[model samples]
Target: MQLFNSRLLRERMQRFSFPAGGEFKKKINVIAKWQKSLRDSDLSKTKEISIQGLFLSKFFGEVLGYTTQADGKKEWNLTQHPGNDIDARIPDGSLGFYSSDKSATKAVIELKDAMTSLDRRQSARRENFTPIEQSYLYATKYDGCNWIIVSNIREIRLYNKSKTQSYYESFNVLQLEEDEQFKRFYFLMSKDNLLGDGALSPLDELLQTSEAQEKSISGDFYSAYRELRLKLFKHLRENNVGYDSSILLEKAQKLLDRVVFILFCEDKGLLPREILKRAFERGVSSFLDSDQRVWLEMKGLFKAIDRGNDKVSPPINGYDGGLFAYDGLLDSLRIGDAIWKEIVELAGYDFESDLNVNILGHIFEQSISDLEQLRSEFDGLELHTSRANRKKQGIFYTPENITHYIVENTLGRYLEEHPDRLPVIRILDPACGSGAFLNQAHTYLQKAWKSAYEQGEIKSKDARYGTLFDYNPAENDRTILLNNLYGVDLNEESVEITKLSLWLKTARSDEPLENLDRNVRCGDSLVQSREIAGEKAFEYRKEFGKVFEEGGFDIVIGNPPYVRQELLSPELKEYCSLNFETYSGVADLYVYFIEKGLALLREGGYLSFIVSNKFLRANYGKKLTGYIQKNYTLVELMDFGDLQVFEDATTYPCIITIKKTIPEGPMTFKYLRLETLEVADLRAELEEKGYEVTITPDSGGWS
Candidate 1:
């Protein structure tokens, strides 16, 4: 319970109203007596079942307000999940919903002795699920159940779970004497709220408020992030001399990237908790200046990250990737007291729990976008993620849902199509921004291989096989970056962030990070061979010789950058015309990505991209559409007309999944036109409501 599973639960706990007035004091007095009895007595030595009787039942009946059987017991009939096979009895108790005597039990409750932790396995088996996990499984499957209560007689926790999300709140019994602790526990679990009318209750109202609050809180991460980014920039700007503003921004970007990498590592336990903070504290304990402490610590920790710490008894291996490679500028700079302190604080932010991968990717993308803006306006007061800015640039970040959907339709299907347990396939994201699509693809592959191995579907333990991409607690970051995934981004920092993210995702304590320079490259994907306007080209045949030799990648996917047709440079347009038959003079920058992505795919290889839907009817999109229709198999087309799938942006986007195979008959494809306005559960919506349609790609304006 110390680790919050979701932002909704965090918000709910923070905002739960503390009960007040005279009546609340009386309830507190009763709770105090129970607390004293449990602690003052020898209740800690008894069996866990004793908790169901002694003080817990009384607390539930008198304070929380749940109905009990005639014998003062709660119901406990629950079936064990197949995967959670263990010799354990049904749940300890099932409480009536909304205090309704007529209704069946709709909430499951588990009890444990004061000595047992909530995470203790109920059975002696090592594979047995923990009590909290067991409770969640049973609660989700139990007829009509929406909530679960787990307690070790010393602390109580409530969980609300759905298929894709989980939320919960925990309160300690020892803190009951305090008004804030007691009130939140009482109000949220009290019979008056849980057993309220079938209509909206206090809990329901709180759910609504928390949902809105979650969005606001998410925005707060960026606000805090922007502040951190700007502060670091200002510090570097002040410290560095004889350098252009763009160089200052680049230095700032590098500094922030390292901080973000370490924060993520700390979150995942690859590094010690408060590593930077400890460094800062070490400076304080040594009576060093603020300017000296942060730089000294950050440099040391980063060095250790690059080269393992061998000073300790059990040496921790240093990461091998070029992320922490020597930077002459950073080495020479010394941050002042105020900026360094602020940075240490920001570094301590809980990146794992609060900023999930998708949000983290957005933070990176938006940070880079904003940082690029800062490059032009070094002294400008404003950084823009404004919708107007996005509209003008035709820029929209591909949300996780869209990325997951595209990956599934493309990469997921590719796996299913091949019966071999683990196929020798590589995935490429030609226009990879923050590597969101590549990250998702890698995650899917990891799970698929892990599940297969667990189910005994794969027998070989080959290092170069499934074991490479699969999670090997010891293998760490090296395997995932070997050859399975590839990325190409124009921005060098984007390439750096992509590697950092993948490394962080697969990082383990004391493991060396892999070098992914060849796998995830940085160059102009549109200009493959010769330079176009002095831009370095990521030539597929020369760069990925083996991939091209074996036809091409098994799957190519990404949300290519969107620049309006008018913005394409003259040289870029010339390159596209010379190299791509699908190119058009008025087509946007993304059009070239689609063409290049497909070109990188072998026959029957899958391709998916979520780009602007203007291509459906825009005059410039005719050649691209016709080329797709004539040369490839159109698998799916999801047209989200006018509905902004992004969080706070205005744009029309469509996901098109294609296969690099010549079509023989009618071009049939799965078609989905979003009918709903909400972005939640998009995969579910597409599956339940999407239908199929035939298309003539040669015709004008495919729509």
Candidate 2:
């Protein structure tokens, strides 16, 4: 039977109008009444099952326009075991819609109680035990069934069994009352939309394409960088350049990164686009076919970028000489006609077309990883063996999801609490390998500034410490970038990459990056030269003195290096143990970083880090844990116990958030034990529960 008459359905939708402000309130009032009655019913667990059937099933069926079985006959047998009893594993209900000639089963849906939510642990309870998996199993068992849905009244998820990932879409039913969200809901579940393509709806196709585009951009950028690196390395080797392989790799990467930034600037309209392209083309032309000419042409281009707007070339505002000032860098770098042509071709790709700062950052990350791998092979070390060495140094980039969660909780929460301090808020990532945290913070601040401007909460003059003037979003972004966002890394290459990434994040088509070194620096953060009281100590102090003299950073965040004491140099290990109260004989370098981050925060400021969860119970962590308890307010802890947040990594990681001030009384903090990486859902659950526990100095260890 046809569940919905197409003609009538179309007419109904055409006549329907969304509710206005009062009308929307009225709808919510009606839902509130139903909720009150349901609570007053005092239903048991068994009775709640009936509510899922009587209310949820019927409501969704009517809304989505699906025909349901009336006699309670199972539409498909999913499990291998055969049983007729309801308790012996039966699908919730089967849905059918009219195809061209006849009614056909379109999807199978499984429902759970409104209070129950699906998580990875529940899914892994048994093979195909979760609602989504159960529906998937049924789809595989039955012909012509391609859609599977799992809902618990509160949240709904749809899956296409034929797809590799299977996951299609998910939405909270409670959110359907919102106008925009309601539109999304209707597009995904409307009878017309679903029946048009049972396997993948139009909305699904759009989402899939967006995801694919992001991946494509990242992949293409990496491919271009890889090609340039290989060609440049081959050219240098052929020319018998005396630099070691490590030095060669570093120089090549630096040159490649600079070229990419110039290309990006060109695409964003900051530079004359065709000027660099044409210059390279002329260098490789048959008339100037000598490899030496290519080097000279490239050197001229670099000189033009550094000097900006000379007598011969137009002024490129905001161009800095720091990035291009290496002694003999241009003189030593020479490329053949073929390599020059290939590099130019790679540069021709559009860098400003829907390319985001985060994606660009990931491209750099992958490029850096590849460079390290190549360096390891050049050193005669096995690839995997070299990777393990790097991991020990805590060189891995933080995954985007974890970074997003940490930033939202720490920096996002801080800004929310103190809106007036937006312009002056200083954020620092001391061990900022490639500046992932810094870049994310810069993006977040820009968005926050724009939002405040739109709301008329900020003005141009108001940004001048205390005065209120006309609001300019672009100026506000520039201010945020220049005044805020600080980072330091021991690796000079990482420091440069961080600056480049941050510059890329805030680059405007009309402006050039004039002074990126003001905020990001290269230094060892933990030990100051003065504190060491030796010849080496003075050098350390000179490097870090200015960073500390600025009244410390207002906010500090990073995934600090995880080297153990055994891996550290004798001098460094002795210094850390003597300087940091948290440092013990066997403490890891990350522990000292935690101490340093805390010391750097201003009074009442915040610090957050993702490090080994071993601090909770390890013997070496006792001093650190005690220091935190006595000095700061523990804001939140998310322990991903044995959950591999980083694929193939051995350590059990946890996120720690703390405020710089001491607690006046019993302090309650949010704690989570995550078994999977469904961070969005985990965050929702945490918010709903508001889990808090009071810890005191008298209380025993965290275990």
Question: Which candidate leads the pack in lDDT?
Answer: 1
Model 2, 507-593: lDDT tens digits are 664555647676777777776665443332323224445545656567889888877678887778888777889878888888988
Q: What lDDT, from 0 to 1, does candidate 1 have?
A: 0.68
lDDT (Cα) of model 2 = 0.64
Candidate 2 residue runs with Cα over 4 Å from true position: 1-200, 216-224, 243-247, 266-276, 307-318, 324-328, 348-355, 372-386, 460-470, 530-550
What is residue 439's positional error in candidate 2, in angstroms?
Answer: 1.3
How many residue pairs clash in all the candidates, one count each? 3, 12
